[model samples]
Target: MSIAAIPTIKLELALQSPWMANQVAITRNNRLFLGLPRYSAEFSTPSLARQAADGSLQPFPGNSWNTWKPGDDGREAFVYLNSVHVFNDETVWCVDQGSLSAGVFGEQYSKPAPGAQKIVQLDAKNGAILRILRFDDHILPPGAQLNDLRFHGSLMYVSDSGLGGIIVHDLENGKTIRRLSGLSVVKASDKAPPAMLAHVKGGTTFHPPNSDMIEITADGKWLYWAAPTGPLYRVETRILRDMTRSDAEVASQVEAVYDNNFSGGCAMDSEGNVYFSETVTHNITVWSPTGKTAVLVSDPRLVRPDGSFISQDRKLYIPVKQPVNTVTANGKSEQRFNIYSINLPRHLDGIDLGRAITGV
Candidate 1:
């Protein structure tokens, strides 16, 4: 499943004024939206949350007092919003980590806020609030934060890096289960050459939220997930759909399988090859069932490729955020981010990623 080296044309979708654009997804109408994690300037202005009635993004609203504070004070009071996914092309869910705003010292010190985070779903076309989901369903340890997610029909699977687990929700029945709590199979030092912990830019070290990233197969039968800090894990939709499955049963199956360091947002081609973003190398790698490695794209311009999607035509659309030149080892860095599309040679035709030993 290898293709010739294709030249990538990088475009700056939104520059630094927006600050730390995380994951992105294309709407049904083909409108592109990127999640802006609350950074100093973005939170300071509430500009990140604002959207016009006509579907254009506007400034985010003010805090409780109607006074807009860009970001939270140097405390655990606020979190930066990171990833967002479009479920039905019309409904979108956004995740926020309240404590990331406090640890902006370039990774020297960081802490999770003593608060339960949330996932907000909004109407992409009308800017209406569909729902806001959060949970106290299960107990969690101190260092936990809700990360990326995916939806199939009426079910939603979310990663909790803070608690080091995955949360599954049946949108139809409102049934929720937090699976694999405190179970992060991928440790920080698992990869060769040591995957970098630095931010998209440079010098800022980023520890594995342990939650990493995830993507469900097109048919919603299997889920391919991995921690940015460790190995990849997957599970069947039947197991996740079975509320009766014991945690141990789920854990046992979870342990059976593991794969590469799929750090960035993931996508599947029509032929079933899993395209993963390797933050450490700044390239996109394809993983096929045959265990063949194909370099989809390898260029310094990509910086950090996050959330991605494949159109029906097999064209790959990746929203790359925070492009930086020199990492911490190289000293000083520059920021360049954008949402771009590339043509792919194959289509995603539903490939079964098999079973896994570890639970998601």
Candidate 2:
């Protein structure tokens, strides 16, 4: 379907409810999950929220999971949500980094408690937390800034953007290892748009995170990612999944793939096409699996599009926010703080492709 085919009236209604969200996801049944990271929120907010087709928002999983206060024990609640995912259509995985910025460590952002900095995995049907995956200081470090994640078989790959590394965790064996930390590719290249570089408060801040967003191909062969200020890179999933591989072995498999200039959030379709939200250009572009690039959508309302999701119906849902608009524009981004979506081609949604396709 063409982008213009999206109803004008519905798009207008979607624009009416403006909320700054870091990420957005859609379930097989069409449920919308919004990741509203708390560290940057100016008002009281739900770190993870669920929005219905009628435009109502509610604390996802439950209110208890979203009501953690400053001094409260955060083990049962969310500290700061950087990314949220609907795993295999029946589960939700919420990535809580436990801090204001992922790169600044040893601050109070370690989730308010020892085990608080973890992934909250819950059953989508009952809203019951099925399990929690905790990363100790040795594995996660304090305020390691777990940015985003991709699942492969019995393993999961998490981006430690804060400290510069990709954490490979084994769900079945419970072994976690941080790889590619020594590679400059996993760290911020300090190549953010020169226009935003002059901003007094922006991406150039001391704690610039590395290896920010993550994506897994449809065949689970390659994993692509980069810092928010980026040049997309990829590595073999087999190397990351093999828990026995040494750090050097895994690092050797890394490859600099696409030159995805400073981008916000991204998502991959089952056909291996990746849709990147161009933060600097304020546009949406797609990189085909075969290494070609093209602009998919362009709009003034797409200011700083962050983490996005491609629905089973092939609609790319995006959340727009402009954290540095104070220097970028007067109030362009603030006015359009909305969850916008563009209709895509017949490509399948990655996460909703099939059950255990990676041989869980």
Candidate 3:
């Protein structure tokens, strides 16, 4: 569809924080939360923080929760927080990648530190930590990174961008299952073109072992995920949550949904409309329930748009990280990273899994 045919969306500046953020979460009351990944030592800000109106980063929940020393247990602190999701129950979930970039190339990062990989749930109303879920070393490889996650009932599915799979967490038993491990569909494509960023040199290619994005259906029945260079895929949540099913059995249940270019992050509205960013094209596209795809917004300023959040009021918030430039320059770059929001149509407001399941 032509750009002029799409609905006119006014890009609203939400927060202009000093530290670059990978993702954002908006609470029911409209509070803003930001996740700052430790891409390099230059990013010394709190891993997970609340963005104030003045663009200051406040240590979320508390200061001690954000502080981590070299010898300290990384599980207790916010170690390389990647994404944050605010649920309908007023709880905020945060994913910690548990490692730092050590080698010269972007793909050759360091191993995760001891007790580094985990998911923490915080009470949104009072900023209190409700629970912490740690992954075992055997299941979560040292190179494995938890990218993004979505909820379905009491279970949470997290995309492992580093190892190319999905980590299914059962809240009831605190047990974890790894699905689609080493699968070609979940892995980043070597043949796909490199991601283009305005300030990066020769563009940034898709590093192997990455499946960085994920989203759940409104009915909490299916999950959709993709790599940067994607043919988006989905699997029935019932197959994932079934403990009796073998890994091979579950893998067979996965199905391809749609082919897409290099996409960064995605979200699904109440109407089952899926929204995702095309990093190379600098535009946002929406896939309706009827299987039609159209550009939502396209602009030169959308440089490397990463994780996005659709708030309760029907506003889509995107974080423009320009990660290619940051990685190519080895984090020694200066770029003003900001959160931008565009108000979606009113019909898209209530189609999230949380509301659909609860009928609230």
Query: What is each predicted model's overall lDDT from 0 to 1?
Result: 0.57, 0.69, 0.72
**lDDT for residue 119 in candidate 2, whole number 0-100:** 85
For residue 219, what is the lDDT in candidate 2? 68
lDDT of 2 at 241: 61
Task: Judge candidate 1 against the unseen true structure and give its global Cα lDDT, from 0 to 1.
Answer: 0.57
What's the residue-level lDDT of 5 in candidate 2?
Answer: 19
Q: Per-prediction TM-score, please?
A: 0.74, 0.83, 0.84
Residues 1-360 of candidate 3: C-alpha lDDT, one tens digit per residue: 332225466678776666678788888787788888765554566777786657576878776778864456676787678888887776789988776555422433356666777788998757788988778866686667888888877778899998788888878787888887777768876546633322242234325437788888767877888887777888888887687987678878888777776777777776666778777788887776555677777887787788888888778899887532333356575545688898775432222222222112
Off by over 4 Å in 2: 1-18, 39-41, 101-113, 200-207, 242-245, 322-336, 346-360
Give the per-residue Cα lDDT of candidate 3 at 140: 82
- For model 2, residues 216-312, the per-residue Cα lDDT tens digits are 7766788888887777888887787676987678877878777776777888776667778888776676776566666666676677778888766
Model 1 C-alpha lDDT per residue in residues 1-360, reported as the tens digit of each score: 443343442332332323456565555455555566645532342313433446455433333311223334422222456676655545667775544443443342245434426677767665565677767637344566777877777778887776577778887899887777775442333453334543443334455566557767667777766776446667786885576887667766663233555356676543446778766676776676455656677767566677676543345667666644434456756453456666664322222232211111
Q: Number of the top candidate by lDDT?
A: 3
Query: Predicted candidate 3: what Cα RMSD to the true structure?
Result: 5.2
**Given candidate 2, what's the lDDT at residue 356?**
15
Please estimate how well model 3 matches the true structure, expressed as its whole-model Cα lDDT: 0.72
Q: Cα miss at 208, model 2 (Å)? A: 3.2
Better of 1 and 3 by lDDT: 3
- Poorest lDDT segment (10 consecutive residues) of candidate 3: 351-360
Task: Show how many residue pairs clash in every candidate, following the order shown.
Answer: 32, 1, 1
